[model samples]
Every structure is written in C-alpha cells, then in structure tokens.
Target: MTPSTAEHPQMSVEDFEDLARHAPETVTLEFINGKLEVKPVPDGDHVTIFMWLLRQCMQARPDLDLHPEQGLKVGTYRNGRARPDGALGPVGHFAGQGEWADPAGVLMVVEVTSHDSGTDRRDRVEKRDGYAEAGLPVYLLIDRDADAVVVHSAPRDGRYAEITAYAYGATVTLPAPLGITLETEGLKDYSL
Candidate 1:
C-alpha cells in the first residue's frame, strides 16, 4: 500500500488541498518540499501501537488533547505540511477548521516507523529537522527497526539539541512541557 503521486512533480499548499479534496479517503498524503509524499495506510500493528500510546498519554496527562493524523503547518514556504501519527497540545488547540494547524499549538509530535525504509528514514531525519525548525517542543519516534523509542527536544537552529533513546520496557521521561514518563512495557515488535 505504497503512496502514489500525482502527475505534477510539485504543488503549492492550495493546489495540494484542492487535490486532497478529491483523493480517496484511504490515501494519506503529505506535501513536502513542493512534492506530495504518499504514505501507506497503517497496518494492524501500527494501529495497535498508536492506540496504545494515545491511551497512555490521555491517562497520564488529562490536561492535553491528542489527535491522530492531524495536519501541521511546519514552515513558511507553504511548500509542505506534516501530519504526525499523534499530535499533543492544549485542549481545543485544533478546534478550528483548516487543512493544517499552527505548529506553535503543538507540544509534541509522535511518529511510528512504517514498513517502508524510505518512510522510516524520512521520519527519523527529514521530519525531525522539520519539526524542530517549526519549533515544536518534542519529537518522539518509535522505531520498530531498532525496537526503541527516541525523544528529541530542546530545538535550536534547525534541530533538537537533546535526544534520549530507550528500549521497549523502559520508561522515557518527557521534558518539562510534557512533564510525564512514558512506560513502554508490553510494546510489541513489528512483525512485518
């Protein structure tokens, strides 16, 4: 279930939105550097991991609101958009209507690795820079390939200044803004 691109090589945000309106609901696309990056639909393991994390966050921090597949405005170029696996922010931060929400409203963004190697690389590298540049406080990456969770924080210049990685079954402490520890017990490895 790889993503398919449009005939045009690049597109503006407005143009991407227009195309998305007619696109199938099952397809997930991210406009990046003027090109649409089609994302594969989530498999069962992906869904299970996402739900588990969402529930954990909700239970641990009832003050924050979590949204799945929520679009984020990352840069001023209008050349891209980012939709994290899960976005955490103050309650009602995304209550309005639009194709994307301001990155300022997002406290953290989480990305779970996909089966595609390219996608996984993008999540670990490209998207990390993008989120940092956008000034998001945290970027939590659940890397199935490594069977570990990595947290990136303290954005500076165009990257996170601090990073900590923990294997499954270990607790990862989120910094001040989040002020909570994520217990990774029972997290399963990817079967793909």
Candidate 2:
C-alpha cells in the first residue's frame, strides 16, 4: 500500500469521485491506494484483446454479461473507484445501479494491459489489491507486455491468495463460479 502522510490520502475518495465526474470524456480516472491515476486510453491491440475475451466469455457463459468499461466501487470501504476494462457478472447485475456500482455480485474483472508507463503499478499491483479487497471472486489480467495470462483468485484478507500465470498457448481453467477454460493461442496474434 502507498503510505499516506498524516494518514491522509492525497485527496479524499469522495473528492476524487467528484473530480472524476467532471473530467473530460477523453480522460479516464482511477483512484487506487490513496492516489489518483489517469488510465491510458487503450491501443488497438488492447481493444482487440478485450474483444477477443469478451467473445469467449459470452460463448462460455451465456447467462453472464461481460460489461465493458464499467465503473466500480473497489476496496473494503468502497472508497476506491476503478473502471475495469470488463466486469463479468450475471445478466442485468448492474441494472438500476448508478455509475459506480458496488462490486458485490461482480464475479470477475478483466484488464488488458495498455502499453503505458503506469501499467505495472496500476494493473499488476494497486488495482489487483483493490479488486481483491472488494472480495470479487476473480481478476484476470491479459498481460500483453509479458505475453501471458494471469489469473488472480481466492481472495482472502484483502488480497488474492492464488495467482497463476499461463503462457499464450496454454489452456487456462478459471476456477469455480467462473469455470471457463480459455484457449489462449488466439492471444498470440495480438502480442507484440
């Protein structure tokens, strides 16, 4: 966790949300670990990867919807706000819910890495912790930089206790509740 001075976040979470609300449409904002981060607009390859995964999820679990770029309240206190590339949940799970919906029934969050300076901390560390803290069942990181698929699951005590990485051609089995097997050879076409 990023330490705060005087136990004060750079700005209150509420303040961050207000600032985010007024930010320009081109700007994507995320508050993680008491810090504000501008998420880079995804590149073509990033979008392609997400779309590819979206199809897989839809085919495997027709009952669930893989929502694109959905805002979510993360962290144990719901203080952190994150807009994941895709949030998988039961159909209509976000209905009647406002912009920043609670993460309660969200089964999995997917993040396709953007080639950016902040991808390491933003996707691999801070956001992972935030999603884990929210007690979501799964976190899937399609790491373009590493050419690997990382599955984060088994959230326990504000962190994911089980993390596994698979190579591009490997078949990865997402655990129960999200029991979909991914044939990741298709990912290689999008890799650098």
Candidate 3:
C-alpha cells in the first residue's frame, strides 16, 4: 500500500492548492499523504549538490532538462502534490502546465536531503513511496546525512521494486528512459 493517511486529511486538495497559491514565496509548501508539509529551503550544500547533478545530466543528455523545484501531482491516484528538487524530462515537458504538472513524461525526480528533523521520513520514505505510486520512473534521493545516493526505480504495485544505495564518489547509473550516468565524486566537495 502507498503511504497515505486517508482517515483525516488536513484539508481538501483544492483548499491546499488555494493556500499554496497565496503562500509567501519565502516558504515552499507541499501536500503529501493528505497532510500539509512545509519543505525547508535548500541550504548552500544542497544547492551545490543539485547544480552538480544538473551539470552531469546536461552533459549526458542535452536533450533533457532537469527543472529545479518543479511542482508535480504525485502519489495514489495523483491525489498528492509535491515539488521535487529536480524533475527531469524532455525539454519543455511541463510547458503551460501552471504550478502542478502531471507526472507523465517526468523521467526522474530528485530530492537532496536537507539537514532537518524530517529528512529521513519525508525525503527518504514518504517521497519515495509517493513518486513510485505516481508511476515516476525514477526517484533519486541525495541523502546528505547518510552520505549516499539512494536510487528508487522500477515501480510496480505502488512501490519501487529495486532500490540501491551508492556511497559518495560512486558512479550511479540511472536506468533507461533516463539513460544518464552520474559520477557522484563532486558530491564529496559539497559535504557540510
């Protein structure tokens, strides 16, 4: 089963969307598992790591673009919404889809762990399950605290059938549809 608390949703999706629209730009908001989530802003280390991935991805597939902080409709039946750190897909894949875009054509989603109390549960687990359920082909989690990159792929039955963790400086290969390779060595330099 997907990670969700259907019993008591904090508010309707519409209400959350409305609130998100009016929210101050300084804060990022997300709705996952029927609960409101305030995503912590990315720190300098986090920013550098994502930019490193962006460079690698661009070099491998200039045809694709890794959009940062792209809002996506995710989770069971697309009921949940999230703004992954990066959403990689064909250039302009999200064109004209204001705010939240459907997960279709989104090859991979990225989340760089922030130094916060919720990093483990929010990024490593809940987001993983949600992206898998959304049928997103890949969910790449840069686990800063663990000093590893966790790749979640092959979604089937609302879960990733294969999960692999690679230590920093390892060569991580993102599977097909997104046939891009990553050399995580640069990640070490950004370590806090």
Candidate 4:
C-alpha cells in the first residue's frame, strides 16, 4: 500500500514527541496545526535535488549550517512542528536543543515538492505561509510539478513581500544573508 496525505489522529505535543522518538524509523510524521500529517517518504529524485541544493548552500555560505529533515518549531503552537526538506541557520544555533529548532534562529527553509499531490500542495502553499508567519527570512521552494524554483523572501504580515521564480536551468539569486545564486542546471523535472 502506498502512503497518502491523509491526516492521522491528532495528538498532544508530548504524545507526538514520545511516538516520534519510539516509532519505527520508516515513519515520517509532522505535526501541523494540531493535526498529525503522515508524509510519504521522499523518492530518489527528491533526495537528489535536495542534496544538490544542500551542497550549493554549503559551498556558497560556509558560515551557515544546513541540515536535512531538521524539525522546527513555528510560532507558539505547541502541537505544530515542521521538518523542512532542508533548514539553514547559524552554526550551533540549535546545538543544545531537544527535538526541534526555534524558527527565530532559522534563516531559511527549503522544500522540494513530493510526487503526491497533497504533499506538494502543503509544501508549496501551507508551508510557505507557515514559514512566513514564523518570520523566517526565506522560503525556497523547488516545485517539480511546475518545473520552477521559487524564492520567497522579506516576510511581513504573515506573508513574503518579495518572490522571484526561475525555471529549470536558470539561476535564481537568493538575497543577502544567503547572498548566492543557485544553479538549477541539473535539477530534474518530475515528468522525466
């Protein structure tokens, strides 16, 4: 059976943390606005693109730290936790944290669209808003469905004030703090 974006039974933060700690490693769960979202494990292409982007970020900004599947606390919602495809922050910003990093310390959040429609929607839409609302400086979205990379920045009033998009093979410049142009030359489209 294939996993879909069906919402799982809601659980408190403590319960979710306990389950997350003891659950099988195969389970990919996220708490979004008091709802437990069971996300499909990323496919190979997703991983490939993510790693490439991660490398780019590292090479461009060695001063910052990047991690894959890093959990984050967005806003004051105790039940909501976000695990971005990749998260960027100052080195050792969350060094002593427990299971999640504070959004205030995060400089950017990256999300690579999943093949699943619901998952894609969440990454492209819901997470974008959530990240902005959390006051994140940037939200980088690699949308396989649309074959484009979008950079959302300058968050204000629960949204980003600036957005720049580039199709595959085009370079997208990330504003200061990141201050780098991402090379999308080898980023694969989902259609392939």
TM-score of each: 0.89, 0.95, 0.96, 0.88
Judged by TM-score, which candidate is best?
A: 3
Say which prediction, candidate 3 or candidate 4, comes out ahead on lDDT. 3
lDDT string for model 3 (1-192, tens) is: 544474467888899899999999999999988889999988888898999999999999999999999999998878888999999999989999999999999999999999999988889888889999999999999999888999999999999999999999999889988878899988888776
Instruction: Report the lDDT tens digits of candidate 1 across residue range 119-187.
Output: 754788767877887889999998887788999999998789999999888988899689878888767
| Candidate 4 accuracy as TM-score | 0.88
Tens digits of lDDT, candidate 2, 1-192:
566521457899888889999999999998877778899998888998898898999999999999998999997588888999999999999999988999999999999988888899889998999999899899999999999999999999999999999999999999979999999999999989
Report per-prediction Cα RMSD to one decimal.
Answer: 4.1, 2.0, 2.5, 4.2
Position 161, candidate 1: lDDT = 99
**True-vs-predicted CA distance for residue 128, candidate 1, Å:** 1.2
After superposition, which runs of candidate 3 have C-alpha atoms over 4 Å from their true positions?
1-4
Candidate 1 vs 2: which has more lDDT: 2
lDDT per model vs. reference: 0.80, 0.91, 0.91, 0.79
lDDT of 4 by residue, 1-192 (tens): 333221333667778777777878898777765566777798999998988887898898888888888888763343367888988998887788877777877889999888885865578766777788788999999888788999999999878999988889998889867897788988855436
Residue-pair clashes per candidate, as listed?
A: 0, 0, 0, 0
Clashing pairs in 3: none
